[model samples]
Target: MGIGEHVGRNLVTKSKWTSVANVQYRTRRAGQPFPTAGQLSTRLITEAKRTAERSWLGEVSAVVLQQSLRDAETAYRTFFASLKGTRKGPKLGAPRFKSRKDARQSIRFTANARWNITGSGRLNLPKIGAVKVKWSRALPTAPTSVTVIKDAAGRFFASFVIDTDPAADATRMPETHCTIGIDLGLTHFAVLSTGEKIDSPRFLRRAERKLKKAQRERPASRRDRRTGPRPA
Candidate 1:
C-alpha cells in the first residue's frame, strides 16, 4: 500500500509538470515549442532514477514506476483527444494532481516485475516482500498483470487480469432460452420482460444519514452539485 501511495504521488507530480509545461509552451511567442509525452517521460525517468537512489522510491519496482508514467501519458492523450473531439466519450476532465489524503491509491505490476503467488497464497512483490492474500477464488491461469489497490476503508486488494479462452467461457455460460430484458425505474427498481417488477429497496432512505455525513466531510472542490441544498 505504501508503494501504491508513492507511485500515485509520482503520477500526480508528473501530470502537474506536464500541464505547467504545456501552458508555458502555449503562452510562448517564440518558435513552435510543444512538449510531447515521450519528451516528458524521458526527462521524468531520468529524474526519477536520480531521486529513487536516495528515497523510499528506490524500494519500488522499476517496472511499476514506468507503468505509472505510461498511465499518465495515456491520461494526457485522452484528455487532448477529448478536447479535439476525436475521442468518443463524455468530456474528459483535465488530469488533476492526486493528494496523499485521497481515498484510493493503486499501482500496476507487469510480468517483468517478477511477481507471483506462492503455494501458501502469499503474493510475492518485488522489494515489498511477500504479502499474505485471501483468495476469493482460484485463478484459472497465471495473470499477465496485477494491480494492487488500497481503498478508502484502508483495505488492500490485488486485481489480476488473466487471459481466458473464449470457448471455455462460452461453455461455462451455455445457451439459455430464458433471456429477459430489464427496464430500470426509481419506484420499481427493475421491470423484467416477463412483467415482474422488483420494488426499490427502503435501505436507500435508511442510509441517507450516513451518506449525508460522508458528503459533508468531503473537500469542497471534490463535492458534486448533488450535495447542494434541496429545492424548496
Candidate 2:
C-alpha cells in the first residue's frame, strides 16, 4: 500500500506538471500546441519515464503510470468538452494538483496487470504480494478492472466492475404500476409527487441546547483535569 501511494502521488504530480506545460505550450503556439490523446501518447510516456527515472518513482509499476496518463488525458478532454458545451450538467474546473494530505487515494489495475484472487482468498497484485481479502459478498463474475482504495479512516477496500446479466437484474426488481417523483429538502426529508411528505430528522435540532451546554462547560472540564477540585 505504501508503494502504491508513492506511485499514485508521483503520477498525479507529473500529470499536473504536464497540464501546466501544455497550457504554456498553447500560449506560444496559435492555441493548437499539443495534439489529442492518441497523438500525444508517445510524448507523455517519454516525459513520464524521464521524470520517474530520476527518483524512487522508477520502482512504481509502469502500467500504473500509463493509466495515470490516460486519466489525465480524460480529465483534459472532459474539461474541454464542458467548455464547448458538449457535455451535460455544470461546467467542470481544470485539473488541479493532488495533495498527499487528501482523505483518499486510489490506484487501478487492468487486465495487463498480473493481479488475481488466489484460492486462499487473497488478492495477488503485481509487485505487492498476496494480500488477504475481507469478503463482504462474493463476486458474481470476473471483474474487468480493480481499484484499490485507501479512505480517510485508514481502511483499504478493493472495488471492481463486473458484467451482470440484464435478465437477472430485471428479475431482482419486479415492475410496479405506481410511479412517483421526489424532491429532497432540508425542511422535509422528502416531498413526493403523490403529495406525501416525510419529515426530516430533528435529532440535531432537539440536541442543540445540550450540545451548546456541553461546549460551554468544556473549558471548565479541562481546568478540572489540570487542577484539583476547589475548596468547599
Candidate 3:
C-alpha cells in the first residue's frame, strides 16, 4: 500500500476521493445540480491541486491528484450514460462511496506523473521513490501510465499501460488451423476436436490421500491422546 510520498499500509488519496464522491452524490440527491464537465475539470480538480499545494496532500504527485478527478468524471459520465440507456452494459447506479474495508483499492497515474523505471530495475514513482519489483516479463515498450493497487491481503500491485508492438505481436501468433473445438470437464482437463483428452491433475484428491495416510500412520502417542490414554 502506498500513501502519497510513502509506500505504507494506507491509501490516503483514494480515501479522500471516496469522501469527495460521496459528498457530490448526497448533494445531488438533495436537489443540487450535478457537476458539469466544466465544473469537474475547472473546479474540482483545480481545488484538489490547490489543496495539495498548501497542505499535506502536497506529498502526493500533482498528476495523481488530478487523475483521481478524471476518474470521478468518467464515473459520473458512465452513470448518466447508463441512465439514458446509451451505455451497452448493465445499468449503473450513482457512484457510491468506496468502503475502507473494500478488498481492493487502486490509484492511477498518467504520463505527466513523471514516474519511471530506475536504472537499477526498480519502479520509480514520482513521490514514493524507487521500489523493487519482481518482473513477470520485460515490458515491450515504455509504459505510458501505471496503476498502483492494494489488496486485502496487504499485497501491493503495479500495472503498466504500454503501447503494443505490431511486429512483436505477430511473432506470438500460432500457425492457423481451420478450427478446433474444446470441451472442458471435471475428470479431464479438456477434450479437443482432434481426439486429445488432457488428463486433469486431481491435486485436491492427492492431497487428501496424503493427509489420510499421515493421520493413519501416526505414532502411538498420537493414538493414545485421541482415545483418552486407553481408559487408564
Q: Note the Cα lDDT for every prediction shown.
A: 0.74, 0.71, 0.70
Q: Candidate 3 on 1-232: residue-level lDDT in tens?
A: 2442332212444445556666766787678776644455454445555774435555667676667656766887788789889999899887665556778777777888788899888998877778899889998789999988877766788899999978888888876869989999988999999999999998789978998998899876546465444632
Per-model TM values vs. the true structure: 0.69, 0.65, 0.66
Regions more than 4 Å wrong, model 1:
1-42, 51-55, 89-93, 187-189, 195-232
Q: lDDT at 224 for candidate 2?
A: 47
Model 1 worst lDDT run, 10 consecutive residues: 52-61
- lDDT of candidate 2 over 192-217, digit per residue (tens): 99999999988777778787887787
Best by TM-score: 1
Residue-by-residue lDDT tens digits, candidate 1, 1-232 = 4555555655554555566556744675676555555565556554555774435445567677677667766776788789889999899887776666778778788999899888898998887778888889999878999998888767889999999998887887869888899999988999999999998888768678788999899877765568667444
Candidate 1 lDDT (Cα, whole model)? 0.74
